[model samples]
Target: MSSPLKSLHFAVFPLPAQGHMVPMMDIARILAHRGATVTILTTPVNAKRFNSVIERAVEAKLKLQVVELQLRLAEVGLPEGCESLDMLSSTDPWFKLLGAFDMLEEPAEQVLRRLSPVPDCIISDNFIPWTSDVARRLSIPRLIFHGPGCFSILCMHIVTSTSVLDGIESDSELFVLPGLPDPIEVTKLQAFGQSKPNATKPQVSDNSEAKTKEKKGYIERVQEGEKAAHGILVNSFEELEPEYAHELAKAKDKKIWCIGPVSLFNKSDLDIAERGNKAAINEHDCLKWLEGREPGSVVYVCLGTLTHTSLEQIIELGLGLEMTDLPFIWCIRNKTEELERWFSESGFEERVGDRGLIIYGWVPQVLILSHRAIGGFLTHCGWNSTLEAVCAGVPMVTWPHFADQFFNEKFIIQVLKVGVRIGVEIPVVMGGEDTAETLVKKEEVKVAVECLMNGGDEGEERKKRAQELAEMAKTAMKDGGSSIRNTTSMIQDITEQLAINV
Candidate 1:
């Protein structure tokens, strides 16, 4: 008799965020490298991005495939190519469910049924809770990629399904989590408007009560779907957060695997190294702008795609960079009007002409961070950004925005001590507040940047720690390292299962 096939086929559903897509693609590539047939499912917009990466992957001979799904919203008459989250934001929760229920779940199920050879398993984003149900219906074992640290996932599980936040009085700091060794200040929780301790969900006026009620119901449905997922896949190293991972394993009945620092898994592969080269952004016609600069001279400032800073904040940041007098590259996304005019009128560009370069739109974040000239990062503390910075051995100036950014900021500053929090008082805005309570002034930003760039006693200490963590991250991704071992084990398990099924 012919030997049974050992190769597995995996279908991955990645959320649209850059952070989510990149790591999921990495995992898919790794599986394909190990002789599995991998197909990634993403929206058209994201699929295009994945295609760019896949083109590079193919040129490098990494065997993987991508499938693009058309998200249907014709009943509401929305245009094609709209983001999944953006389309759902303004609509009632029930209306949003139509996309997950009718659009995503239905379409995904159809694709699976029609596959030439059905997939052996489905890997999905935890954000798309409906995926679990679809996988179950297809009799495919499902894995939910958490896309963040175990602590961050555990925190979200507590905040979303439970009344943990309700227990904390407004403006009062309560130690809110159970899994971690130290108490997590209630202010550090990542939920709707919780980054700023007092920041609360936006309250609807009398005229919008009906819309508000619909939103509440929508949230309930989403939560219900989240509770049904089979297993959780965390993109973190057990060595980095053993305590939190253990706690999560106990609290959640699902299998948890710490397979990460995924970016570093294939440094020795020439093809993969060349693929990394494509992520570089070209601006100002100077690719090596910071070449030969002092080891700790440049400060790389990048706020992720989703964040938008006000003109006031922009001006303050520019002035702060000037005050620091360090070579810097700032990646700014112009999502609002008047930002360009304000920069020109303020003469901020002239003030730091050669000292800084501010590029608009997306940046080659990974390449820039990995550069030797980039000694530190002024970041929004997004999980991907944080992990990249750690891998690159770059320290950070933490300025958290929304969602799990606050939790990431805490881990970097408090737990890892590889970075410094820019402002002393964590800003808190009570729910429905009209104005922000704590604003990061220009001087504070300057001091933080300077401290990280110029090595003072404390800066030196942080610098040493940052370098050590960077080495650890690098070691973990090497052959026989923790991340590679876990990935190999995962692939072996899937292959064995596929053999039995076949």
Candidate 2:
């Protein structure tokens, strides 16, 4: 029989953030591999990041393409190049970025209307909930793409769907998240929108209040969009979090297709190394560094793209890594001149010397994690980073900065037992300023690293568990695996629905 996805067109929209856009691109490629004609909707700046992947897809003769839309940045009072989250300044208000995303709706609708074969479905990032409306207007099914795993999604859903936060007195007060397969303990801050005790709230002027109100509406619309969509496309596999996955599907009453660790879909070395951005360090140089280290003897440190680490924290981290005396590869993003000056003046780099390799920009994180020498990862616990580490069977030193990261850390440390936390007590959202004042000192960092990488029964067990999950992750992508079956079912369901509609 012919593939159900054959000739079916899918217009995929990803929110213009690294975490959001990367997986959505992977999903687009995955769908095209299953014989679907996939068109990715992206902005000019965001589209450039996917050039390599898109080229490879086309070269492989896959029916995949990217449509770059000119976002009305000036109309929204955003700067010309402020298309993605990483491009946003610390001073830029969050609502203005949302306004820029709002501007894409009209152009997106126009593009969808003009496509040669009408899209059978709209697969969109959960953040860009406005795409649901575009799907509605175009009379196509919409599938929400949730980048985080079922654990985080389930926690968020339970908290949002009910008045769980009603009458909560303290941000640190723990409550069991109701209606979950497991009694997951969560604090108000952990859930969402809770503030620290005696914390000075941002002074909201009338104009700022209006913008805040608008942002609230945007969040509500996101939830509404999910409710209205036909299903959710999660970058996860059933074996990874079977209970949470089952619980989430039951709670949402929506078709939840867990088709991921989507990075695995890219089999070629070039595709793997160059998955997101061109490697800042040469891929060969990175591999050469790893090759020199003994098996499971190196610590890989990367705190994801959006994390803004202060120089003080960097020095502390540098000291901690130096203290470990382990072979290490650390990738630093958003490197400031002050950071460079510190490295030059303090001789910190010289002290670490050949024992440590630091890439001051983007590194091929997945490639590095999969290396045999990588013993552990010191990470900010971003979902993409978390999933990548899990697939590589590498344990983590969790230091979550913001968004769903804290929840993801819980899943790693508590549920999976394959990681340890570095004791970041409060969550900090990116507002373009130094939000991560809850600095984890050097002692905590050193201890966490030792706990995850050192020779102890606990450490050995963590490694064993992580390896098991990694095998399961790889298995899920193979034929008859959970992910492959889910992908087929998703396509078949979409095709059957379209037939009924026709």
Candidate 3:
């Protein structure tokens, strides 16, 4: 990697979702730190949410610009204001959302061309496979950014594409895939057994558009696009998956950069530096609940934005948390009426009282995890939440639901050894098979929580491992850390290319 300070602008395009937005914002910041101006390509609705973050970064003197593509719901045949996948009431419109992503290619390309420096490259989310062609059209290098660890990437590639689990027919039947650093016993439930999964991990069918009618599925197109990319930048570090990092790069024969848990370097962290890794939380009342609790006593429960559970399951989950008798902060982001209906009918709110704090919207996840009261995370095992739990050093009660999350749970339980498996394998979203009978019984949830927070030798050992991982994540982003070195090398490589292009 060359060290020439060539001025190269970057266009960081994120898939229009909270999970995609938050991590890519950090990537923009990382590039800005390397002396490059970055423009975040996103939707108008998402832009409004990002304005505050962008404002904060600019306040901290970072060269960050946000360019919104005109993705309106009605224009794309979606409901009004339903720009993000999470914004939708049900996952049925997910196909429309995928189609909408293709619609933004032209608008995104326009932003890239209109920029003064014309941008050196397009760093896009893996979901937006169309951007690789957009980069080709503009004759610029393109890279796909994955918001997961190296282990999750490996599992995603292997579990879905390989015949590794051919023999396992039952849901709990465990088998190990070939070529991983360690043995991971995955169940048939881990597979995309939930109806027909499209090209990407779980699946979403592409709408009838000539542009996307490649005979191949969306995920296949993404893979092909990535194969032609300059590199794949993952939100991970060498310390976590050192062997897999080298193995994946050698296997793909592409320049892979380990430049994350990128969220660690946000300007928001500077304000909370004195308070540790706490970010700003939407619900301030959760903090008050935590004030009286002991350190490592409260359970932090949240099934990410997209996961949807039936009202029955919500009742069971609420009861399960209540049964654990441990103070908890449960963050649920389903429609307000349903959440209220279930909680009211079940007397869940009255039962828990001050013991459990339920937030109906997105709270400051990282900030909450860094709180003194949070001891365990009941998570869906999405990579962002998974990485956040790792960074916070809290043991996870792994309950994976969708996408590469099952594999992420495998990484947390098998590879990282910092989380415990609760065997709640099905996604909450309705559409698949009848899983009502298999809903994680309250006893199962109770036992899982007990296994994580109970004062047992195994639980204590897991807690110790989680704390060790937290320390490694903390040190890896410091001045001389491996992640820092990789980030510097990545920027240098790009600037070197820009020098040649000119």
Candidate 4:
């Protein structure tokens, strides 16, 4: 009943964001299932949120535990008890979050030094670059946890590091991304939204009071941890982006391991059942509505946690979704006060009645995407959501809002050949941080939706390829798949290092 790999112990520190936490927790689950002693270093408030899940896992006898390391939000000017970035009411907290993240190093190192049975290695989100220093001082190997696939990471690397877009001044100028397996075209607008390797100093901002000069140093050092990490751990299979994975390793000069769709390895059906029982969710209504629909007929919509659009844009989007005349479930993410105004005035709810469902709060995304009724996804192209859609075999209708998302959109359309874009007229600048997205007219939305669901040649081709990808994703987690072998290699690498450290 005991694990032979009990001698291998690991400490995991995930960035306190929903997207980051979910995948990292899955990594912990995989490690613990393999008999490794796992300590998840997190803030007390954030730790408590995930504790119930870990408790259940432990009750099921997985070797995992959550250790709350002190993280004083007040020290960094955030309100008391503001545990996660998503809890904040603001639009741009990138620098503010980094400042708070930097403050955790002292507490984390103290926790690491005193861990009774010292861990063999530390696996951390690359956002928390400071952890690499702690691991080095403590004589342990540290591995970087990347939430996005190799394709997105490598695309960003090339776009930022090289002059891939240096000469272009026009938004329409398209260039092929260097070093990719497929030829992908990007306009000046789309490429400029990415965080360049050497960013020019900002002139000034309306909210400059919230930032300090010290935080600028942290921003510059975002990629510094890669140089110090033992290797990089990515949440993608080689079959999904084999060439990009290889290019990423060569670009960063770090050994790479592809050991995910980690969520596929989740050990808790109880967790899902508990979530399903929540009465306020109205999940049953969605399910009931889906029951009558033909297979792969409905569209699933979610724009992710951080994206905020103008009220005008929301109305436009709602009108656009309505124009499709097909069934849809849109997970709207605006303030509760403003939701009714958008829906009621447009007669949006009344117009579509049982056909269009608007979900305001948390909904089981992974479950919804995999449902038989979900033929297409209208997504913000966040990595976690992108991979989930790919695994679910649902085609994407990508409307990328920020960061790695635009690049991820390319991965789906250009590389995977499983989705279409909303033809966002102009690229929303810098992850939609400084500037607001220009309205994607109702017509653009209607056209993209029509293409994805029309069952025509292009639509059928995309659906076929998406289903094939779904098969590959499932196979990757199977015993003989590349991911399973890669996972073994990661365990052996750490286990070997643990022996040397011993």
Candidate 5:
């Protein structure tokens, strides 16, 4: 059959966050490779970051382009160079950044208008719901790209749509989420953005109330935009969560495309190494460090980019890593001067000696996870990390921090049986002061790591299941695989819908 994607043009816009942007870029590459012309729309700083990916795609002769939209941070009352969320110092600027993103709609629409071949589809990050408006004006279909997997989205839908939380009084009380293939256990605390009921609440500052209103307005728009969109494009595969994927489609009443483990699209070593930000450690150095270790002997720890660890939490985590006495590679972020002082005074570097390698910033996560020496992962259960660990056949020690991570942890530990939780219950908002007290202590961390890394019947069984999932992930990306078939079907359906609208 003729490729439905042939000569089609797609406009891709991703939110300027690590987790959201990376997968959307992968999706763009996937579409270009599938014979669709793709244009990635973003601000100047983000456009610069896409240079490497764009260059590689161009070299391979894929029809991909990037259009830069300069963000007016001053107009939005945000600092200059605050193009991405990571650049912010506090949560205060978050809403302002969202406001700045709103200013881009006109420029983006104009850019779309001037393209030689108008885009047939607009695939934008879920946060940028105004793209639905752009699609409406241009008379093209819009598809929302949800960063999390089908299961998490389903859980979120249930929390919002069903009476699941009607009588839940305590944060730690467990409840079974209704309408799923498996009875997934979830605490009220695990619900994303679930507000706490304080008996004696502090008076809300006028400024805080304004910010809350702005946030609420933005969230409502996003929900409405998602409903108005033609469908959803998720970074998941059918075999990975067939029932949940189908259920999510039914719940949303939209055609959901599970075309993922999208990281697999990076076939070359250079692509893998340079997938996200430039690696703090060289690919050769990282591989050399793992070369002498025995297979399945090392534990790789990284809590993702967005999460911040307090000095107290860092000390506890460091202590836990020391207690395990296993070969490890930990990628840490937000290295404060106090943390450095503690590292120096605590003799952490001298004690661990050559047994542990600490990367202070970005490391090539995908490459490290795929290494043979990687036995277990200490992760925050972000969708990317969870899916990457599954793809690499590495069992996880899940320590979910917030957002969809809690749901992801359950899916990893309960559904897949290839992970162990570190016993964190309460969902934390970013930049909250109470994080130090709520974090998993050293004992919990040590025990979970030991359980995952040490070889036992249970550990071996987990390894077996992980390897099975890895094989499934590989098959799903191959020719005639579930993910590939989904992609083809999505393109064909979009084409039919566009024709009907015409």
Candidate 6:
């Protein structure tokens, strides 16, 4: 050695959602373990969430750093609370996201400029395009991390370039996607029939006509910014989606690395039970509840933070679970008052009694999945949940709600064959002027739960597949394995590129 191979400085910008933040944190941890000086930049809110994980990492001697960037919108004339992606979801989501990037550009630049030794490379979320510009201005290499599956990223590229958004009629299925191996249904798209025709950016003028024009102009600019990014990083393993990842690489003439199942890599850095926001939930109560249960007997149910079901639907689900009579740990957010009220009124708490545990607010999802008692997951098919379930060797009962969840459900049931769909029919409403429709009844729920709990021909097959995928996930994270190799290669590539430019 040449100076014992000095550690490189890498900056990460994660999308402000729990799903995005978790995977990005995993990547940050891996880099830190490999002796890279990592700085994770998040908003004040997300920074607080990151503190627990950072503390855990530091305890393990990972040498990770967390930086909180306060986002101000007044100077940019953008709406308040536009600093993070979560704040912009309801109000002009796309533009607010762009505005967030604009807001971060100066602050990020100042932070990097002030550093004694500049960051060797900047890693950014692909969804936010402003990082590319800042990296260019600083003459630093930018690596764009796609926080979703490779197929999802490919779909985004196709939708943006082919004007698919402009042509999509309400409820019309986009049967043929350009780059995908199989046709993707339009309804399954992330925007969920919301991508308007000629949907452009907001205009500078206060007048309606001028605003429409400005909106279009702004959208065009955002698209161009995304296209000009330096390189792309995907949160997926090549073995899982080889064909899709290859297609993405060829579509964008930039270096693409598939470093994923990031949650698996995180296991080595921190205890599973210690991974969540402690302030949000009672981890001790959750673990104690799981401790009494037999191995591979409980069902873990979570619909993620964004997917909200109606009161009637929640009641239906509760009844279904009750009917199944399975030991369950259901993660319910505080917002589901209707469901909570219904449970109270229906004697649901007494019905399940000691057999069920309802965790209100945030749950330590990774811990729950990894527990010995968790046999199957009743999921909403969020990519992060899917990956975690896979890592934990847990089969699933797919109940997709919205966005790319439908696509993920298809992948899990159709492609992977590691889980069973809850049922094709939508859930029916009961009583109170609610229209009764075809629903996955309590009977079907019972059958699925039984199959998952007690091994049968089909259940055994699914169990075997789930176990195989879990092993694959484990192997991918081991030394010199796909995930580790890809992460190491990415760091080396960035370091080399920086050296060449210098």
Number of the top-ranking candidate, with lDDT as the measure: 5
Which tens-of-lDDT digit does each residue in 1-502 have in candidate 1? 1111466788888876666777888788777766667888877777765566677667777557777777665554555555543233222222432344245777778888888678888888766667777876777677778767977767666665466666666543646565467677655334543433332332223226665675566556555555665556777787777787887877776667777787765453333333322333463243468674676688999876555455677777888888888889898765446887777787877878888877776666766677788889999787878988988888999987656777777788877888877863343222111124445778998988887777589888988888888888877776677766766666566566555655
Worst 10 residues of 6 by lDDT: 425-434
Q: What is the Cα-based lDDT of residue 22 in candidate 5?
A: 88
Tens digit of lDDT per residue, candidate 3, span 466-502? 8888888878887778888887777778777666766
Candidate 6's residue-wise lDDT over 1-502, tens digit each?
A: 0111448888888876666777777788878877887888877777775677788789888768887787665654556655543333222333444555557778878888877577888887765567778788888888877656877667667766675555556443535665578755544233331222233221122337755665566556556655776677777788777888888888876777888787776553234544534425566777888999999889998877654355656667777888877899887654555665677787989979999988776778888888888999988787889988988889998876544565677678866787887764232111111124434466777766666666578888888888888888887777767877777777778778878898
Better of 2 and 3 by lDDT: 2
Candidate 2 runs further than 4 Å off: 1-5, 193-207, 433-437
* Candidate 3 lDDT score relative to the true structure: 0.75
Please provide, for model 4 over 132-204, each residue's C-alpha lDDT reduced to its tens digit, 9 standing for 90 to 100. Answer: 8889888999999986899888877787678887777666678888777788777655654432322322211
For model 3, the superposed segments whose C-alpha errors exceed 4 Å read 1-4, 160-173, 193-217, 267-284, 335-338, 427-434
TM-score of 2: 0.96
How many backbone clashes does every candidate have? 3, 1, 1, 1, 0, 9
RMSD value for candidate 1: 4.6
lDDT tens digits by residue: candidate 2, 124-187:
8888888988988887788998879999999888777788878888888888888876667877
Runs in model 6 deviating more than 4 A are 1-6, 59-61, 73-101, 163-179, 182-222, 268-271, 274-276, 335-339, 423-455
Better of 3 and 4 by lDDT: 4
Please identify which of the two predictions, 3 or 6, would achieve the higher lDDT against the true structure: 3
Look at candidate 2 and tell me the lDDT of residue 299: 96
Global lDDT scores for all candidate models = 0.68, 0.83, 0.75, 0.76, 0.86, 0.69
Query: Model 4 misses residue 393 by how many Å?
Result: 0.5
Task: Count backbone clashes in candidate 2.
Answer: 1
